[model samples]
Target: MLTLGPERWGGGVIFDPAGYALTVSYVLLDAEIIQVALRDGRRVPATLIGLDLEPGLGVIKLEGEGPWPAAPLGDSSGVAVGDTTATVGVDADNDLVVAQGSVREVRSFAGYWEYMIDRAFIVAPYNPAFGGSPLVNVRGEVIGITSLRLGDRPVVNLAIPIEYFTATKDELISRGRVMSRRPRPWIGVYVFPGDHGVVVGGVSPVGPARQAGFRRGDTIVRINGEQVGSPEEFYRRLWQTPFGEEITLVVLRESRLHVLKVRSADRYRFFRTTGKPPE
Candidate 1:
């Protein structure tokens, strides 16, 4: 078991007969050390192992021997959009509680391996403190790890899909991180929304675009020699090129026409580290 403090914290029961347990990182991220209180109120020291970066999961090792009850981790891939789930965690005072909710939606972003779990028509008894709490099925098998809130609604929570755990647990447990495939080619520029067009603000050093003489503040008028109206269209065009395939970007940078051919890297690397919900 692990928690935020003697007060409010989210933890898990190590259902594994071998004593393995699961929990979320936000509950443990700032924890320099941990202590688990047994059912008998005996407190024992525990150690923080590490976390899963993409899904943001954490695992800890409790000291001393136990006959701790562990919950079986379930296959979340077997879950459907409307399936029912149970979210469990500790409240503000560290009391264990459970709330019932139906799985609402499963959304995956570009390069994301785990789908984000959303719950509808329900709310957690506890607040966002349960960042990595367990979401279980009717069979009491752990299916998801609490992750984030969808949009601006606190009641609408998200979870790191369990499949990512089953697939990467061994790797994470051993290496503390997973090596993702790198994006291969590059246009070498960062783009953002601009009035009436896409604006290039920063350039990647030694990238194809720099080699082609593209400069900052340049407006991208076309990609692949075809006219593009906006940055969205520009990105859409860039994504069309197959991975590792070289493509050309035609743009008017500082009133000069230029073309650059660049290879595309695997996109998965960018997805994991970027755009996570507030902790």
Candidate 2:
């Protein structure tokens, strides 16, 4: 259980037998104290190992003994758009809740709360109660981790593919995160796709964009001289630039294009060293 003052939440599957656990970073965000509850009802303390924001994965080291039951990782690349699966997680009562489902689509999910998830697996018939729930296949192998719950006819859920964990597992284990010499550039603006260009809808209170005099309703036309046609393109282009680098941003404000230079900072760096993580 992760406790931030009085709040508590569950985490992800244990892929390591020696007490290492994998979870989303948001689960441990601003957490003052964290505990790992075992199947035998022993709630022990857990420490933050590392987190990578680019792919959005968190790792933790639970204080426990050896020979734990770990989930088998499945090849998410083989998951199809119609594959049937199941989601298992803890509910509000801390009771186990499991539901069956199938993949509805595989696409890039973006422009919501400044969250960008590429190759997100949208599954139907299962509504996730919390993050870090395992999306398992018929063979009991984990294909993805349930990250979001949206819509409800039969209750659709979103999960991050398991491959993201495997790809960054070693880096997180050793360095506590993706150790890059250069961090990704972040201006801290939440934008959406518009007919003309990428439109800024929300600005982070302490982000570079807000500090640099960016405003809401400003449509972004170009970044670092390249045109941004969509929200995804804008984010992709931003990630391509190095963190802490100065870049040119051309925006259409009041039907006129204005060029502004912004000094970007590392997003993960800002979140880790500063206050609570961005919502």
Evaluated with TM-score, which candidate comes out highest? 2
| lDDT accuracy of residue 4 in candidate 2 | 24
What tens digits encode model 2's per-residue C-alpha lDDT throughout 210-261?
8888899999999988989988888889878876788899999998999988
Clashes of each: 12, 1
Q: Please, what is the whole-model Cα lDDT of each candidate in the order they appear?
A: 0.59, 0.77
Query: Residue by residue across 126-214, what tens digits does model 1's lDDT show?
Result: 33545566788889888887765555544576666677677777655554445452333345577766664667776655455666666
Query: What TM-score goes with each of the models?
Result: 0.56, 0.86
Off by over 4 Å in 2: 1-8, 38-40, 113-117, 151-155, 180-182, 254-256, 273-279
Worst 10 residues of 2 by lDDT: 270-279
Ten consecutive residues with minimal summed lDDT in candidate 1? Answer: 111-120
Q: What count of clashes does model 2 give?
A: 1
* Candidate whose lDDT is highest: 2
